[model samples]
Target: MTGKSLADYQKEYERIIFFDQPRKDILLEGLQTEMEKQFKLPMRSKEWKKENQKIIAMYRKIVITRTL
Candidate 1:
């Protein structure tokens, strides 16, 4: 949560998923699967609470820099 809305997460998620393969067919559900694998924890897990801000900032940077 960390003061960021779901929309923010969605926007970042979209950019992260499409950064490498913009033409690929990546569903929203697939993003969730990938994120869980990447973060090594479920979204609902307490670990995400502490890492939320860092994760958001990281993805925002990736989107801004376009350096996947």
Candidate 2:
């Protein structure tokens, strides 16, 4: 976050998150599905609060725009 913009970080985040699916497909064989669910469960809750909400929302917007 020092020299990079949120958009750049968002790109990297997307890359890592996207990379995870194929990695899990090859390595974990769906075993970590529950773990991923557990991890995402609180992301929309009060766990992250307002600060991260802005960032995540921004990332989601970027991803949505890219997909469309």
TM-score of each: 0.33, 0.30
**Residue 27: error of model 2 in Å?**
27
Query: Global lDDT of each model?
Result: 0.51, 0.45
Across 1-68, the per-residue lDDT of candidate 2 in tens digits comes to: 13445565555455544554556243332323332343342545665645466555654543443322
Tens digit of per-residue lDDT, candidate 1, span 1-68:
23444466568565656544543334444544444556554446565656676664544444454322
Clashes of each: 0, 0
Best by lDDT: 1
Global fold similarity of model 1 (TM-score): 0.33
How much does candidate 2 score in TM-score?
0.30
For model 2, give the RMSD to the true fold.
Answer: 8.7
